[model samples]
Target: MSTLEPIQVGLSNALLAPERPLPPGVITWNGSDPSVRFDVYRNNVVVSLTTALAEGFPVTRALVGERFFAAMARCFIADHLPSSPILSDYGDALPDFIAAFPPAQGLSYLPDLARLERARVQAYHAADAPALTAQDLACQLANPQRLSAARLALHPACIVLVSEHAIVSLWAAHQGQGRIEDVDLRRAESALVLRDGDAVLVLPLSLEIGHFLVALAAGAPLGEAAEIAAAAGPDVDLTQAIVLLIHYGGIAAWHTPGDL
Candidate 1:
């Protein structure tokens, strides 16, 4: 196989990058003014890509007016080409791009907000797992010391996010314009995103809970994560966070680390 064939194949399928013209023998259309025919395809290509981008970053579009949104979309398309056929996965680089975009500078938390949105979408597709309930925990918590060293299992859809700005407010505000008058944008926040059955929920997390989840995600034992959470923030309530984790999908089950 020649290198040019693979290049042609890639260009044909890639929706986000510039369309490379095919070799002379690759097409059936023969016309003196071929550019006109090609223009139709080019327009379709641009529309398809722009539409996907707009769907992915509607918040970004809302923040930056429509004209600038199209311009930024063009830049984003040129810089990072689509690596997959799935349009939903197209804008993973958008948050990073927004951080560097000059006009978007005023929205300092835009990147984190984008991250939160992406996590919500990804969490929606995460594999399903049976969640632990209070009844299940009542039986499992019987061996209190054993539970400490055991590896805690987080649900497949559980995700934790940490932000330095009020991204949670940004996300909630975008949910509707009603509470827009009451929200103060200066507050800092963090959140946990998880799936319960078919619904995806983004619940607010206290700073201690966020740190505890991060520690658990880092493979810290339950006892160690609680300790780390305490060391970082003295007010951390292990019992409460643990209960919520089990309640929300942050935790699915407990197991002795080496048990077969």
Candidate 2:
């Protein structure tokens, strides 16, 4: 037998608005003002979900002011309910929602910026691992026979984003109090967000580099992944990409996952 989602639509609707009437004889009161008690639940839902959206899309929040951020967040929350029990996963669909939102029609790039932010939070919570060291790769290369069966792993906190807008430039510019410059919407860009040591760095990736990382991240072996990257951009400089990944802790180490 199939299971139904336990989070009922009525509870969701009630939590979103205190004024929404509940099922009969199910008054929410514990001797306190019933209205205030219900307000607590309603307030918690809005605040918690709104905060999640804000944290997931700081750039988007910054692009529009606080009032509009709240409005957009409320709209998002109404149309989408969190599927995961974990609060961190609450805003996963927000980027796509923003892209389709009619009011944000003029800001086509907003969704991509939200994408960057969402990836950032996920990277922050990714599993920790000791990224591959320079000496490790060098030693592995010393033994040519190890090539065919060797494997590589991506770091737990690595996230790669490929977008056609200058999202990184736009994100960096407005993160601080400076005169934000006008950007050409026609520009293309990509970025790699990863946690290195104590800091999360959002590094802009060259088109070829981004494509290469995307393939490796999808489980392609290094040699073939390098070929795809090179084919895309002849001057990809695979060594440089590896250096960046190692330096930023985006890749752990290579290993055959199921090999005995």
Best by lDDT: 2
The 0-to-1 C-alpha lDDT of every candidate, in the order given, reads 0.75, 0.78
lDDT of 2 by residue, 140-223 (tens): 666666564555677879888878888888888877633467665567788999996677788988878888888888888776
Looking at candidate 1, the ten consecutive residues that score lowest on lDDT are 14-23
lDDT of 2: 0.78
lDDT of 2 at 141: 64
TM-scores for every predicted model? 0.81, 0.82
| RMSD (CA, angstroms), candidate 1 | 3.4
Residue 250 miss distance in model 2 (angstroms): 2.4
- In model 1, where do residues sit more than 4 Å from their true spots? 1-32, 177-183, 232-234
